[model samples]
Target: MKQSSEASYPISFRKREATTLGDHLRHHNSVVIIGMKRVGISNFLRFFLHHQEVPTTYIRNGAQLLTVIVDLNDLVEREIYPFWVLLLKRIVDTLEQSKVPGELKKAGQRLFTESIQLKDLFFTVDCVQKLLGQLIDHGFYPTVFLLRFDRLSEVITPEFFGNLQRLKDAAQQRLSFIFTSFRPLYELRPDVFSKSSLSVFSRDLYMTPALATDMTTILNTLQSRYNLNLPKAVVENLVSLSGGHVQYLHLALLVAKKLRKQPETREELLELLLKDEEIVLQSEELFASLTKVEQEVILKHHRGLPFSQELQEKGRYLWETGMISSGKKEIIFSPLFENYLHRIDTPVHGGTEFTKKEHLLFSFLKTHEGILCEREDIVSAVWPETAEMGISDWAIDRLVARVRGKLKAQKSSYGITTVITRGYKLVRTS
Candidate 1:
């Protein structure tokens, strides 16, 4: 949904004293803002820049380390360089007025000496230490703002960290360093820096995409920003489907809003959700990644009961990985995923033969609920040539018992039921 410029979502700042950038800036000289992509790291940085008075310099992507150093030197030398150039020009003008030079005058000999000697010198470790000492003498302290430390980790080599350590040692309290990373610091090499000098903000400390609390904040923001009264149920469903990932939730809301603008009814919202290309693509990808055994389990469970041993194993794996939940003996995929699965065609497993006779037997029992089918009828439906082949009644009884045992094992109260003498019936409790 396109929100007006005036419409801004109120960011829910963490309640803890030292959590946010503003809060940390007030107390600590250096603060690191880190989180997953789209978790509002940039927004937080922008917030502090807008609200606070500190000299904020954002190092975007952190790839241009050398450029940053050159820029810093240029900033330091701006005033002096201009004045020096002006003085040289003035001296040349005075000499021309005095008519001291002939060819120098004809050539308009304007001396422009732009020296980056000091800047080039700072590239060396010893020279950088000396430069820091000179800056301290001149009361030119700098607070280094290193944005996207994750990007830096990718771009910079091991020598970069070594040089950074030297820079830190040389500057000491005179320079404050703020490093931001998307990934966890622990995931990186530990020998990169001393723990005391570094500050880490991880998913554990900050709200992660999977958290319910973060999802609530996102829902509230969407409602307030769009001025749309999103139903609580709708928000909950979106949260459950997206697993509280902000980008995914935003996409869902955007699609819903677009559909709502078409003057659709509330009931049509579910259809809108289902039809959204973003959701459809993500769901398809999720289903595609699942194993064939897992798909079989889902399909078999959806049909009714009698799960194969392989299906049960896959179900247990899915449950452990948080893809689904097991209730007693019943396995349930998440509602969102289940709905998506229902919309798609059944997937094929290996070419294992399914008993058609078993299907017919179950179908007959299901059709005649609470009524037993005769042995002759059962044979006719399940095994057509059984009478001619002289298949005993015990064989049919064993098959029924196998079906019942499977049902019982899966904790399904439905399936084949005993009828004492006549035959079997499917008990429909629901």
Candidate 2:
């Protein structure tokens, strides 16, 4: 009899050894002596704060510790005042909705009312600091403010950055903050290039790709849970192809689950990924999430070239995203993706005719070559000036389909395909 999914996989896989940051954040400390002491005090304080009636279960999930998170990428524009205003509103709303102790709820409500009354940046900053102070005084010590951003180099503006600095300075010691970005922090904010700045942002933790052991554990856990009757060799192949990238590994498993028949051999898995157009097309959605520089990093790493030391942060971001592994390796994290890229380009037999739109689309595809092109990217490139005029995905798809027909008729080998979740890429089946 097949074992239950919950029984086979268990929650242990989900709770697999937490990342260093996770551990630190979860315990408000680390395994180190200093961290332990700090955490002990924090825990003691928390224990005292929890009255018998106040349900402690709310804070048990490590969610309460993270008071606020601002995702820079989600903002349409980097307006500091509005962003903070929105964040403050969210905090107030969440607190209002939460079943916290009466005192805490009242304090949160008062802050919300006071925050709404503040109209100027100067007052906003002061009020935020004051509210944080009040929270600490009321035994809500160590309120962690989390700032999460991707591609900070591009997203961060001078005005927005100043606000962050101000908050860091104002909340020092009383509140703890964690700033996370795909790239290194020092590279984004100015004047932090010095050794002193490094000290200010101490405890730099890098999350490398998963190790072999991690992959094995994940695969075994997934296999038993899903009742995927994959052979040992096929499982080994899946690991080998994933390059220990957690994201790609998960994707491969999902693909395996979607297959009608369980693959018994490595070659079958590869065939299911590469030869299957439907499965490969699903990758377009995944491609859409990558920035242009990130896409380049993946392609360059695939081609066995090292990006500049200056570009190392970009590489680190890609590595963190599970697209590529570190070291002198040319391996992409996804075998299916690697195969898809390899089989993208085929030989063009002769001169191919093109429409005005087709010409532009074809040229763009050629420029990008093996790189994944997002739907929006194609829109911007093909209709740069008319982007505001609104180029829909359907328009791009229809244009590409027409172009594909022409390429086939003209006996050209180059093809453009949709990577379902990602976007599109030009493949030449040589």
lDDT by residue (189-249, candidate 2, tens digit) is 5443344544553344443445565566767766766677776776788787665554456
The segments of candidate 2 whose C-alpha lies over 4 angstroms from its true place after superposition are 1-19, 22-78, 93-101, 114-124, 143-148, 151-155, 188-199, 212-237, 275-337, 340-430
Could you tell me every candidate's TM-score relative to the true structure? 0.39, 0.54
Q: Report lDDT (Cα) of residue 95, candidate 1.
A: 34
> lDDT values of the candidates?
0.48, 0.54
How well does candidate 1 score on lDDT at residue 190?
A: 58
For candidate 1, lDDT tens digit of each residue in 128-201?
34444444444444344555454333334446555556665676545445565543354444555445435432
Clashes of each: 0, 27
Pick the TM-score winner: 2
